[model samples]
Target: MKPAVDAIVHAFETLDPEHIDTLEALYAPNARFKDPFNDVRGWPAIAAIFRHMDVSLVQSRFVITERIVDGRQCFLTWEFHFSFKRFSVGQPQCILGGSHLVLDEGGRITLHRDYWDAAEELYEKLPLVGSLMRWLKRRANS
Candidate 1:
């Protein structure tokens, strides 16, 4: 499982639209992927999500920071770095998150779930919605 996990880490670090197709090789046909905004199955749907991200953002990339593996499952911590294509300034933004992945005997991922705060990690970064989100967060805290 080390080799399989290693390959997945490497693939994510170098993932791009041009090599989007390569991701299918790492996931099962009916694999499940769920994140803050999407819950999808199958490699094609998963690939579409990645493709959409590439189209919507500029210079997006993942930087894996840590991982914990046990048997056929693992948890990974990463930072997603990118700049918005339409919204506001061109400052680099980073979303801190983690993922839980379960692999099959063949080393293909069967389940992938990403954990992150939409309000803090994404919505709060927008130019307009950012202020609103921050206010809401403050209200919730106080």
Candidate 2:
């Protein structure tokens, strides 16, 4: 439980639209953040992405299942639990993923990259695309 990793876990665990202001202390001023759907630099851009998430999802939270740290770099495996505003209401969804983070000497994140499968975790759960995506997966596997 390094200081940087602790900060990240705490920040994500308690994150929400209102609490997003707390990110400034966790990430560097010019930090870069990237995921399957976004690639952005600087805290403002990063915060914007999170704000979009707050608006789009009905509810969302992250559970860090495992963490490995070495020097200033760390890898975390997590489960993102969420419900889409436009889709399921009471039903919850989960995406299993990992993140790679690089921190500065001050323990503020300098780079954050997330890894996850869009097809399996997202598209395959959709109403129309789900069928096609499942078919494609079956074809690929068979």
Candidate 3:
């Protein structure tokens, strides 16, 4: 079971979009998924999110730094690299994040929650709009 999680993590880190096909075997049919921008229900929705990621980010990769599992739950810390359509041609930027996953009786993920600082990792990576966003955040917080 642990090895299955490792394989999934590896697939994610490697940014292999083809892995989504195996998700039906790894996640429950009604799995719940949550991230900074989306709160989705069911495996199909989760699969769509992965598909969107593959299409939007060129050469996207995930690198799992840490993983801990207790019973049916696992926590993973990871770093991701990818090139956006507008950023630096083909150069990838790194984004650090983590995920908490709860497995079902069959050792398939039933719930998955991703955590990341979007402002620092994504918003700051934007071009001209990034500076303005930073300024507005600073001013608004002050």
* Steric clash pairs (candidate 2): none
Candidate 2 local lDDT, 1-142, one digit each (tens): 3977897887897787788889888889999999999999999999999889888786799899999999999999999989888766657999999999999999999999999998899998777888999999999999
1 or 3, which is superior by lDDT? Answer: 1
Residue clash pairs of candidate 1: none
TM per model? 0.97, 0.94, 0.88
lDDT of 3 by residue, 30-132 (tens): 8899999999998888889989987788788788999998887899999888898666658679899999999887788888999999888888878876798
Q: Which number leads on lDDT?
A: 1
In model 3, pairs of residues that clash are 13-62
Which segments of model 3 are wrong by more than 4 Å? 137-142
Q: What are the lDDT figures for the candidates, one per model?
A: 0.95, 0.89, 0.84
Is candidate 1 or 2 superior in TM-score? 1
Instruction: In angstroms, give how far residue 5 of model 2 lies from its true place.
Output: 1.4
Each model's Cα RMSD: 0.8, 1.3, 2.0
Cα deviation in Å at residue 95, candidate 1? 0.2
